[model samples]
Target: MAARSRRMTLPSLAGRIDPIYKPATKPTSDPAHSAAFIFLHGLGDDAEGLENIADQFQKNDKVSYMHWVIPNAMEDRDAMTTAWYRPSPLTAFAPSRPELEEEEDEQGLVKSAAYVESLIDACVRKGIPPNRIVLGGFSQGCALSLFTDLTSKKYSGRLAGIVGLCGYLPLAGGSQLQHLRAIAELPPTHGDVPIFLARGKGDSLIPKRIWNITLKGLEAFDASSVEQHEYEGGHTINGPMLRDVCNWLEKVVPKLED
Candidate 1:
């Protein structure tokens, strides 16, 4: 109701990727943007998949001042479609046994993490600090978003919050993840940042065992700021779910003037 949506292309560290950027309708402090949310899409999807979300929020005057940056994932060479990382069966990504877990796409994860950081840097350059920025995604995007936020040395524990929709955590356990935590220097209070995680009741894309592991993994970090939800439908975003996310956003990123 207050701003117009436009197409944008931001250069990514992983490769030359075109991202859809939606500027906030009004600034929290006149002329200087207040808060931003850098949201990524799921595997086999691009920026368009999540662009409406920005529109959904901007229509509500409460969050019109929040900027939204949605980036596109490069087309997977093997899958022949857009993806944030190497194309792998989501079911296999997080298995029950650590020894039997699928080998993660470390290269893709690292590069994408760098790309996410670049997006954060872009927002920071625009005057928005890390504490005012929230990163989130759906499905594969959720996995990458959480993973990136968790491992990126520059942003771990510095973000305002994270929004993860219908996705499982990857590389959740083992000495490797611990090694990564050490490298990132995440503190015991890393859980201080709020999180919004949701799952579908009838969804088959994410198995029960893997989802449990995801919860367990988040607990390992003492992520007590989590608020999880479950919808009646399947692995798709619904109106109720969006409403819940919007409400969560209201709690995490309140009006600066308030």
Candidate 2:
């Protein structure tokens, strides 16, 4: 096993970012970093709040070779707290979803997606391939990650996988998103990108209706590669879920040398 190192603080761009970056504990390849997982923390949380994932994985040699990028969400002025994007409360599902058209924060969503891409760009600049990178998040972070995978022009269908926990798909029924999805023309690889989504059975924020809707939206997007997990809890993570996430990360971005 490799020795643990201090966490490295990476600057956010344009004064809206500060991410905790952890390099692989053990080098699995010549350059020492074989794969990367960029995770976004939920609303009201910072990168440090989600640093335990790195603490756990770095000690385990199986995935210790992975570089972890955990980022903080910028402040949502409306809510007066940190968030990946502005939170627009979801109204009940109706055909055409006029609420989505009128209330969803389109500008904030696009900007946050770009921030995620910038994180990906940083990893690519470090020499990792797009297919070796996985994007993931919790709550608001999860929502933004899924949206980014669907809408990012350079990486829409090119990431290794996506992990969304305790989250619902945002702007699922909106016309603008529908049009963007159409224009994006997700390559066949988009469907091939594995999506690991887990929800808490007792989660009040994401009721049964919302989960079903999220699933349907993914299906409409032609997401054939997805793994859905259900755990006993509320709008937070549990032990079993974390264990499953570690296992999933191993499978998604495994050792290239092994």
Query: Best by lDDT, which number?
Result: 2
- Determine the backbone clash count of candidate 1: 0
- For each candidate, the alpha-carbon lDDT, in order, equals 0.78, 0.80
Candidate 2: 10-residue stretch with minimal lDDT:
1-10
lDDT tens digits by residue: candidate 2, 1-258: 121224333444554656777888875555424888899998898888889877876766658778888877777888799987788665345437453455677788898888888888878877788988999999888889889998888998789999999998888765566676667674433467899999999887777677888888888778888899999988998889989988998888877764
Task: Tell how far residue 251 is off in model 1, in angstroms.
Answer: 1.2
RMSD of 1: 3.8
Q: What lDDT score is found at residue 59 in candidate 1? A: 78
lDDT computed for candidate 2:
0.80
Q: Which residue pairs overlap in candidate 1's backbone?
A: none
TM-score of each: 0.88, 0.88
